[model samples]
Target: MTGKIRVVVAKPGLDGHDRGAKVIARALRDAGMEVIYTGLHQTAEQIVETAIQEDADVVGLSVLSGAHMTLVPKVARLLREQGVEDVLVLAGGTIPEEDHEELKREGVLAVFTPGATTTDIVAFIKSSVAGAAA
Candidate 1:
């Protein structure tokens, strides 16, 4: 709505795998949104700092280290603590269905597990941001 949606795709914690994050970043860019990838091995602080610096509308985390429970909330908490309350936080990776509610309660907008398509990610982001604006 306000120019192209600005998103920061980050790989937080000890997760060494970045192929998924890279693919999502390219897909988001291809869909006409501005994507800032923070690369891999980012701390929650780094991700939140980058989001604020970039004035990101959305923050997407890619985690496959089974640490989503710890990592997601840390990122969300840091974002709020830094006063970026309007930033939409989301995650994608090996998260389980049972963890969805807990993640949402911690302020994650949504969580996409494996097998989620890029189109769905893009669409969900666009609609979620748009809806939040409305």
Candidate 2:
């Protein structure tokens, strides 16, 4: 990769809880990637816009509001609709196992659930973004 992986960490929908999102953002940053956190209550449009503006290599979405079924796919669809072909989309926080495969089909590269280590997340971004960088 030419530089550090650029990641957009976002919280979509009415998810009031953000501890997980903040933790991931800090981990990514500490791992040397550029992390742009969109804060709380962001819409799919806002997240996609930030990703495009930031030219993110990956978009790490954290949703704890049980709306991942709706919001996650929306963000993924928006990215594709906007022609963002290179950014790898990832999701985390309270995702059910049943929804994992569907999220992948909808364009989310991976879904990290509860108890996922920050080191693993860092490693995944590094490897995934490197492959995409090619």
RMSD per model, one decimal = 0.7, 0.6
Give the Cα error of residue 127 in candidate 1, in Å. Answer: 0.8
lDDT of 1 by residue, 1-134 (tens): 77999999999999998988999999999999999999989999999999999999999999999999999999999988887899999999999899999999999999998899999999999999999888
Off by over 4 Å in 1: none
* Candidate 2 deviant stretches above 4 angstroms: none
TM-score of 2: 0.98
Candidates' C-alpha lDDT: 0.94, 0.93
lDDT of 2 by residue, 66-91 (tens): 99999999999999999998889999
lDDT of 2: 0.93
Please provide TM-scores, in order, for all candidate models, with all chains considered together. 0.97, 0.98
Q: Model 2 — which ten-residue stretch has the worst lDDT?
A: 125-134
Clashes of each: 0, 0
Model 2 residue 59 lDDT score: 94
* lDDT score at residue 19, model 2, on the 0-100 scale: 98
